[model samples]
Target: MAAFRSVLNVANSAKLALSSRTMASHPLAGLLGRLNHVAIATPDLEKSANFYKSLGAKVSEAVPQKEHGVYTVFVELPNSKIELLHPFGEKSPIQAFLNKNKDGGMHHICIEVRCIDEAVKAVRDKKIRTLGEKPKIGAHGKPVMFLHPKDCGGVLIELEQE
Candidate 1:
């Protein structure tokens, strides 16, 4: 009877350990915040900016982000914003995207996070791959990281620190 009780106790302890590990790996609530912006890859920056302006949206002037190899313009909306991306340099990251999508289209979506480091860890724990090992300064001058599109239902996801 004593030996049987010891075995039962060991099984119960193992089950509790497994459950604790599962809980620890689960994503924390409120890790992700509001949608920051939706990025669009455009061949003609001015035309795209004009289109938004024509729609009575407040559009920002093109700002060159040489480090990121793209020029960006923000179209302000009540809820969120639209980021228009144009290739800046020869090795612009969005060049291939523009080539494939000549008319311009939705590129990526940026979502705000309270803590970027914590968000990255949470995604990585769930086997999601980040585009870069560390977060980089994004167009909004905030720390941002892009998650692998393949893991995110065929859509590129950008997590920006808010």
Candidate 2:
């Protein structure tokens, strides 16, 4: 229909505009690529994974990162992946997060970037606080860093190197 076509045109135009626009004040603007994954912290990773399985999702095995102190699992989907996270060691980085959110909920969202080092420096220069000393190799085997939730509108953001 003509009406539907017009609406689609407007939507496509909006997407193109957003994709090309860049911010001079914030260096990260126009740099972040796709939404790599959405992460959820779970008290019981097995139970959560099983719940997704009930919905007919293919879930990955629990992968533990000793340095990061979290066990991770990926719920593979047709278009994207959902990462299920759980605290592992005594000094898990997720402890404080779980302490505040007892039921464990959406933890962070990861966006891809071409170069994480450059991205880190740019955001750091803008006074954004990062979780650790430097980017660590994440579950995807890519260098990733976490931006403080306070600086990121109360939602933790992970920037992964593409």
Name the candidate that leads on TM-score.
1
lDDT of 1 by residue, 35-117 (tens): 99999999999999999999999999999999999999999999999999999999998998988998989999999999999
Q: Which stretches of candidate 1 lie over 4 Å from their true place?
A: 1-28
lDDT of 2 by residue, 1-162 (tens): 999999999999988777666443346676788899999998889999999999999999999988789999999999889999999899996777799899899989999988999888888998999988889999999999999999999999999999
* The best candidate in terms of lDDT: 1
- Quote the lDDT for 141 in model 2: 96
TM-scores for every candidate against the unseen true structure: 0.83, 0.82
- Which residue pairs does candidate 1 place in steric collision? none
For model 2, the run of ten residues with the poorest summed lDDT: 19-28
TM-score of 1: 0.83
TM-score of 2: 0.82
